[model samples]
Target: MAKATIKQVAAEAGVSTATISRVLNSSGYVSREVKQRVMAAVTKLHYQPNAIARSLKQDKSFTIGVVLPDISNPFFMTICRGIEDIVQEQGYHLLFCSSDEKPEKEEQLLHLMVEKRVDAIVLATTGGNEELITRLAASGVCFILVDRRLELELSESGAVVDLVAEDDVYGAYELTKQLILAGHSVIGVINGCMGVSTGQDRFVGYLKAIHEAGLEHDPALLYDGHFTEAGGRAAVRYFLQMAKPPSALLSFNNKMTFGALVELTESGRDIPGDIAIASYGEIEAARLLKHSGIMYVDQKPYDLGIKAGQTVLHRLEKGLDKSLDRDAASPEPEPIRDILQPALKTLPS
Candidate 1:
């Protein structure tokens, strides 16, 4: 059987094709009664609106592009769920892409989003590509930053566009403080690569905690891990063989934490007995640990995702007004940045 068209639906509802189209798109003005009739006809015919035809007519795909650093990361999945919830309500689809922490891949995905004419883009960008992001913002493509911030050209008009991130430094500071209170004098840190803001901020937090606690911050205890399980395991091995092995170990991210656990288990080392282990983020690995007093910080992934979606919708509804300076008292709705606090959780001993 031939699929029902907008014209057919309109005829069934005793209205014009334009009216049916308006009701379908949920754009422009249509009376409540007319909307009900159109919807009734739609249900009766089981008619589906052609997204392509609608896009051509309205010059909108009703699609939002979500470019993530790594889809395999469970944290990103939580954020994706939040984005999905908001976009679905508006009948918009998500064009999801993972850059896998590769700068070139990120660049390609951004270009594709522009080419596809996505309504907006929410990206977790690598430290590279400030110029491309700046250009996107200048061209009026709604862009928002999540998880990672553009370190360079951040002050460049429209470079960041919008931002939603955790208080990385603070979370790290809090985590480090907890270790100190546990009487850990010599602490080892498995840090993420220093290219991203998260890594740098975390290192800063670790430094602050060390200084405030009046403990010597030994550079030897620090190891730059690529935020992976392998890196965590390697750091553990490096620290264990040190002249004075650290009494406590801090893993910067979940992947590193995973490695730390595996190494401890395989090497027949007891956690919280021989070496106390802690990390930045909470996951099943942290939850299942035998040590009841394990400490970590939660970045509130779901909230960050929801805020990212809200930021884009606000930009869409109110339009991007870059003319308004943030320094001003009554600034226009320029690029909004939301930084949420990370919650600290300590498992009972």
Candidate 2:
């Protein structure tokens, strides 16, 4: 079977190729009667527009690229859903790639997105490639940093980029404070890698709570879980080996929380009995278990995605298209810093 062409559709519809193009692109207005005729012809011929040719002609790809640290994580998946809900209405497609928390992989993915001529990129950076990110943004690449960000402000580096994330510092502080208020003087922290902004901010928040409580900082209680399930299990084992273990525990993310729970259960430690456990993010499985009693901060991943989507759309509408060369003298718009507040949920034991 042969693929149908625009010319064939136009001929069948008894309309010029220009009219067919206008109708297909929904550009110039065509009469209602003509539109129906053209659509009918399109259906009969099964004509499909060449995406590459259309993008080249219009200077727009109608595609958004997304690079996430871990695509398998439900947290990131919710964010992707939010972004897709917004962009899909405007006839834009998403190209998703996971960097797997590796800098080299992230760098390669970023370059691939540019080569594919994506209209915009939503990234959960692995805290590497700040220089390259800055350079690309400066060169008129539309970037929205979601969940994680660089060390230095991109605007300060002369690269305007939008950010949509939760208030990690405050959320972690409040979560830690909850454990402190529950009368846990000695608390253990299953922390993530301190390389990314999220990891750093969350740790800072935990420290602030400890400082305010006048509790002596025990370096032994801190375990770097590296935001992985295996790391979480190892951290639990490390804490168990300590001569004076913490009465309470805090896991920074859902994955680590899960690992901690599994390790504790297998080791015959009762929750809220032997040790109270809190988390920076909610664990979905905890809800199914009776007497879970897990205190957590709800980071609205989907809402963060919505904000990122809205920001990118607004930038594109404001003539921040990657196809156009930005004028040097033109003042750049202030970078968007949208930080959503997290909710603390403390369930009864």
Name the top TM-score candidate. Answer: 2
RMSD of each: 4.4, 2.5
Let me know the TM-score candidate 1 reaches against the reference structure. Answer: 0.83
TM-scores, in order shown? 0.83, 0.90
Q: List, residue by residue over 1-349, the lDDT tens digit for candidate 2.
A: 8999888999999999999999987899999999999999999988899888888888789999999998988999999999999988888889998998898999999999999889999999997798899999888899999998777666555677888999899999999998989889989999998889889999999999989999777888899998888878898899988888888889998889989988988999988788888998888877765676789998898898889899889888885533447677766678888989899997667
Give the range where candidate 2 is weakest over 10 consecutive residues by summed lDDT.
319-328
Task: Evaluate all candidate structures by whole-model CA lDDT and list the values in order.
Answer: 0.84, 0.88
Clashes of 2: 0
Q: Which stretches of candidate 2 lie over 4 Å from their true place?
A: 1-15, 29-45, 153-157, 321-330
Quote the positional error of residue 197 for candidate 2 in Å. Answer: 0.8
What is the clash tally of candidate 1?
0
